[model samples]
Target: MSTPSYALRDSMTMLRRNLKHARRYPSMTISIVAMPILMMLLFVYVLGGALGSGIGLPNGADDRSGYINYLAPGIILMAATSGAVATAVSVCTDMTEGIINRFRTMPISRGSVLTGHVVGSVVQTMVSLTLVIAVALAIGFRPHATPLDWIAAIGLLALLTFALTWLAAAMGLVARTVESASNAPMPLTFLPFLGSAFVPPESMPAGIRWFAEYQPFTPINETVRGLLTGTPIGNSGLAALAWCVGLALAGYGWARIAFRRHAKR
Candidate 1:
């Protein structure tokens, strides 16, 4: 076969492998749906009433449902974050199973194997995000922004997931054992809690406040929130995109180097 045809075949083959991996344990898909629902319910009905005043706005500026406005974006970020949890474990599983070593012998692009996994994860994560949004709407979450901003926010969420998934890929590559891979995502998962996702950064401690205000997740959370609430957020949207793209490049670069070197060995 010609070189181009071989590469195309390899990417498609890897994509299918990723899809198969996603189905290997059906409970993974179930947990993805269930966890976000639990978080949305817990935040909306339970903590929301107690913390409603902290959000400082009704659902749609004048619409009494403001809590949903505040809670919805937070849920989206958290939902996106939840999707990265299993990445490390899955990556480690590939290494453990000797499949990656098998791939090393093939003439395919080494990067495509990792890219395919990320592609599959992104698709699965978006599906989870869609379900979470539906539950939020059924519970009274509404976006005040025009359809454009709504689309932009979802686009941003996908970008956020896209980049973060690469970081997860890097962790999977560098981690020494399957167990460490399981623990790798914990730090990334904890990040949203330090941001405006759950509460306004101004409400946090000065030390924590400084961190939250400047962190990448804050802009991501704000951009999405501003979109949902029709609030004015200016350059921060660009700032968030920059962060996502930057991380994606850095993570993918390192992971590609590692995979290439590992394959050569």
Candidate 2:
């Protein structure tokens, strides 16, 4: 087999290993899926009424149903980010536990180790997304999207997941311990809250409003909200695409460098 074939095979093997580990210890995946769902329930049931009134929903539909349509996209974005911690922790565990040194002695592809982590994380994130969306629907979040809109929304989410998982993998590579790795991505999990996730950026004060408007997750959330809820995407689609691509490249480069630096020790 050629080099690329070997890399692909090794990556697949690593992905299987990661998935098996996730299955054996289901706590991480369950937490990743649970946080978003619980947040959705909290917002929809607890604060949906008051927050709904302020979001400027059409036809004065500022109730639980109306609020859910606006809130579901952001919660879904959170779900994507929630998987990052798992990726980081898993990678760091392998690093600290000396499995990486064992892999170094084998003939497997060098990049496959990281590739497996990334691919497995993306797979796990997508599953979490599915569950979140299901719960959103169950909770009266109605979207006016067409088939194409659904496709585009899901694609954008997958791209965001891919980008974040790579960044998390890099964080894991650089962290000295599993606990630190888990904490490293905490800001990412909460970043959507600073954006237009829960409320419009227009409602925020001066400084935070500006940040809520320009932040990466803001545009991404807007694009997803527009696609799913028919909220007029404007230029958000382009911005979201740009951010995803840029982040993916940056994370990939960072992870490779960190891996090489660690391999030297």
Clash tally, candidates in order? 3, 0
For candidate 1, the 10 contiguous residues with the lowest summed lDDT are 55-64
lDDT of 1 by residue, 1-265 (tens): 8877776778788878877877887677677678778977887778776677655654333333556678788888888877776666777688777999888787777767887878878888898999998988899987777889878999999998888888888888878888898788877766888988877888888999999999888888888988887766798799989999998898788788877766666
| lDDT of model 1, residue 15 | 79
**Model 2: per-residue lDDT, tens digit, 1-265?**
8999999999999999999999999999999999999999999899999888867776455887788988999999999899999999999999999999999999999999999999999999999999999999988988889999999999999999999999999999999889899999999999999999898888889999999899899999999999998888899999999999999999999999999999999
lDDT of each: 0.80, 0.94
TM-score of each: 0.92, 0.98
Off by over 4 Å in 2: none
Cα RMSD of predicted structure 1: 2.1
Per-residue error for 19 in candidate 2, Å, reads: 0.6
